[model samples]
Target: MKNLGKKIIIIFSLLATAIYANVVAKVYPKNVVSGEVATYTLTITGGEVNKPVISTICGSNVLGTSSQTSIQMINNDYKKSYVLSYQFMPQKNCVIAPVNVEVDGRMEQSNSVKVTVKPAVQDKNADFVVNLIPSKTKLFVGEPFNLQLVLKQKKDAEAVDSKFIAPDFKGFWVKGESQATRTEEGDFIITKAMYRLAPQREGNLTIQPAQLKIATRISSRDVWGGFMPQVKWKSYFSNEGHIKAKPLPNNAKIVGNFTISATADKLEINPNEAVNVTVKVVGDGNLEDIKSFKPYIPDVNVFDEKINIKGNTLTQKLAFVSDKDFTIPPFSLAFYNLKTKRVEKISTQPIHIKVNGAVKKTELKIQRDDSIKTSEKSLHVTQKREVLSKVWIVAAFVAGLLIGILIMLFVKPVKFLKKEKALNLNDEKLLLIKLLPYKDKDEEVKKIVDVLEANLYASKKEKIDKKILKEILKKYDIS
Candidate 1:
């Protein structure tokens, strides 16, 4: 009877605990700015609890999570609780839906929570500020422009470490340019980073705020009774930037001011030899917008090499091989010129090539020996002549074999016998052609090609060190 009573008491206690078990959800700092992290915590009490499965919090996946377990005894009754905390960064206002958690083998749902996220506000009076400045707010599609991220910090606020994060350029082709430049102003220091942006589509595109995280050095006492350096990090955000891109007229794909020029290594080549031509385009706009040039000629095999672009210049290498004379037909490129504010076309003149020593086909005719008759004496003379001809043929074959053996024994093999002409390393066009084959294979070779093209086509020529070029060629065993 006493055992039964104790079992009943234990059952009652379990029932009471199950009835009192509950889960609650809470979020601190219900309001926050975009790009700021928010914390959500779930508390479970009075029963065995399992880890909750939270897909997302405040419309963003949890960045990290942590849990805490606590136990207490009050008035001879034991109490236990579990708390799960999740961290997430919210980009906009959102509502966190209810999450289900298992407690004592039964599911329990927590109440929903709402968070208000506001756009980042720039504070001018703060110790540090970030600003995203665009060169132009309005431009045509495919037009190239500059975007600068400027950071200003007061002289008094010394940062021990700093990092900058750029926003996703959704509708633009972005290229990072030169390194950031630092300058000092009155009572503040300024740093600027430049990026080249070209719109991919026509629309009103929004660039999210850029973030700058900085850490300041501080002194803290360690357990060893010595002061240690500690850092406190803070993030500053730049304002959002908007760009209005308009469509180009006449379905033009390029927007820039450019000039096209072509040059060939030779206007005349031997039969089966290649005539190398380089077509270059140079100006101050989006050079990458230019497409590869395909020149068509009848009965000629044309090979287009990879296009090389450097700064405002673009170069394309081509080789034409044929046994007959052919003409490279003129081609044109149309682009919306920003300087002219109108559509303009640039074209290349037709190039004619002549092939030397081309083989020609000829018909051969044979006369029958039966058309003539000869006496016995004449026939005997003809037989003697045939025997002599056979002996001479055999003698010539043996002599030729002996000569070939003598030559092979004495002569050393010459590598690149066909390329006997010394390459002109000073000539940008020739150097570019030589280095192009190795461009994709080696990074240093690509840089050389870019420098060569820039020197050849860009308005501001890049200096080429012939010694350096020779060293690279020697590394590749290229003469």
Candidate 2:
């Protein structure tokens, strides 16, 4: 009887828990300003001891309402209310934005919301920020680079009316920047364009200060980082950003540094026998236009060299094609150093080249006399058979006939052709008949006719002529 009473109490507890879980969680925002701070409150009667993690629903165009941890709600069991403060900065003009609410591990349904941002005024101008995109501490002449600017924003602040103004770049051309875009948290982004900077004179060039103005609906946010209490009420705020640029620190040329150096495989070369010499200029500078390569020595022709340029380095390969001894000339290059504020020079060592002309010209030739000797070894190669051309076949037939006549006049041929014996005719006719199929009676008859006609016309080996001609003429009833 006591156990039965305990079972009844357990049943009652489960039923009460189910009833408590049915009260759905609800959170609603209190007066939300466009691009300004707002507050939301969550309520659940007889709620669970664990607070439900809340998040914005997906596919919402508004910024503050969409990101995780955007809204923070403090539990208030005493007042039966939990409140979360948020800042809304909508990028698009949404008369009805999709604002999502999440609870119970699943994102709840979204709420249709109207959004508006207060227009910025002159008195509510924001501050300036300067950021050097593609920021490099060094540069060289004839180099291309990119620079960008952005209007930065503080936490809980919106970047509305803002623009970047480029500074004066003396002796350097200013390429334009791309159009601005607002980040998800409402920051204006400005991208600088690309440019080719050619420094006519080498030196350090300082870029001037760049400025920007950002217009906002209210006064500026605190510059220093700290918590801005949610209870603090302000009707207006301002936001702005600016920029300034500085030159490279060291005495670096626009492209880099310029210097020339040369080297030879050997000082002596036999004429017609080639020797290789390589000249390279290493430094940060334009190597594309350094065309002429007259190795500062005697008998060096610019035409004998092939020049190649990669980045700031110039390179060349010289083929001493001449048959005379010569000396390379000394070379010096000039470049600018930013730290020194003066021009720097680099020198190259002198070189001597000897071309021996007394050597055999055939061996000295570029075609290589060794190749001719290799071809001589291949001249005796024999083929299994030579396929005769039409001209050769015709010539052979004519020659054979002439030789046959010569044999008839000067040698013995009385047993054959025009002097045939009965045995010879029989043999010729039998051999000709054997060429056709034995099973075909018609073909056998045709062969017999062909044999008789062949004897009346010419030798057995030759085709049947006048006798066949007569038979064909008779079939056609021709004269």
Candidate 3:
């Protein structure tokens, strides 16, 4: 009976222990270096437990959180344990305050842990270092350049399992190439990457440091003449750099090395016909800056299609229409060339076209003359026949006049004159009125007219650009 009672008491004690929860706190790496990560774990055992909530820890920044659970059968009783971990980055040498947590509706506290943050460890015997190199440090806004991320290592070291972390390019546009090239020198091995970067903002810009995580193998000879090797992993960082981007003058937008050229499918065509014009730009810089290649020509219909970019080439296609022969003015683009260090201008050649008038009807005139002769001969016929012939001739004359009026309205007779009467355009205002197209109020036309008037009437005669007069005539649908 005594043994039976003792066994019952022990079983009850075990049950009571299992029914309650046990909690404790643990800190890893009591000593740490500044800027290093430290781990803190909260352990819970026995009965079921909710997740532990962590309190803020001083002198450290919480980086992340994680949790784990496990179950075991001990002495015919089920036991469970849970671990909640928090990762923190220590800023300096200081005492970490006690962390408070709640588990299973009970508040639990962890003991304070002291951390000795020492200076960062450096190895001067390192075999290699990573570098971020740029093609140029100074640039104008909207200018583009190349950047290289390189890992240069000594010949004695072998690099393996290399990983890279790129910097945050906040104010720049970056085009990155994925493949990394490996090259070997006489005493070094290099891994490199190429990238194209364009500054999106003006003023001072900084590129953050790049990181490289790599493992290297070193071989040594043992005392017994046998080779012993060891593999170690280390992280390397590249220096942070700055780029000075200057603002453009007069709000100039384009910057690069480029050439502009234009071509037309048909230079000459009838009125209301459309001609296809294609403009091409070939260069090594930002081709996307040329978003449009549309030129506004007076009295001509212009329709611009989408801009196409393939490789280093940019092409824009447009359709043009006019009612008379016209010369499309030369198109010019002004840009700063980084290589030449000067503002250069490129322009397309002027395009000229001829428009032919509608064909005239000579047969109608011949018919009218024959009808007049027949009427004159009718005088010798009988009186009844003469009367009928006279009526028919009058009717033909009226019909011909009506047809001529309709032709005049369709052909716009004023524009068909071979030469202008000087008396009709004695006033400069009259000349401008005749030259201005109803649909065009272009400033270029007005400026040309002013120059023409000054050259023809000013005290000092200046040579006027004859091309301007020719353009004005075509714009108004005049011959």
User: What TM-score goes with each of the models?
Assistant: 0.59, 0.27, 0.49
Regions of model 2 farther than 4 Å from truth: 1-197, 200-256, 286-291, 295-300, 304-307, 357-479
TM-score of candidate 1 to 2 decimals: 0.59
Q: What's model 2's lDDT at 99?
A: 34
Say which candidate scores most in lDDT: 1
Model 3 vs. true fold: TM: 0.49
Per-candidate Cα lDDT values, in order, are 0.82, 0.48, 0.73
lDDT of 1 by residue, 1-479 (tens): 99999999999997776556477788866887677667899888755888877767765899989887877665798778888889888878878888888888988887788989877888877899989899999998888889988999899988889887787789887744769899999999999988888888899999888887788888987534589988766678988889999999878788888889999999998988999889998876666667789777778899998888877788999999999788998768888887777889889999988889866533332233332334556888999999999999999999999999888777865642456877777777777877899899988788888887777778557777778788888988886
Candidate 3, 1-479: lDDT as tens digits: 99999999999997775455366666677776444567777767746566655545554557889886777677898777777888876767767665555555776555566766655443435676777788989988878788888878888766777777786688886644547899998888888888788888789999876756677787876434579996555556677768999886656777888888989999778878898989999886666666687888877789999998776688989988887777877877788887777788899999986666723336988899999889877855667787899999999999999998888889866777757653343345565556555325767677766655675577545444557656766766554
lDDT by residue for model 2 (274-327), tens: 566677887644455456565543444444556776545678887555566666
- Ordered by lDDT, highest first, the candidates read 1, 3, 2
Better model by lDDT, 2 or 3? 3
Clash count of each predicted structure: 0, 36, 0
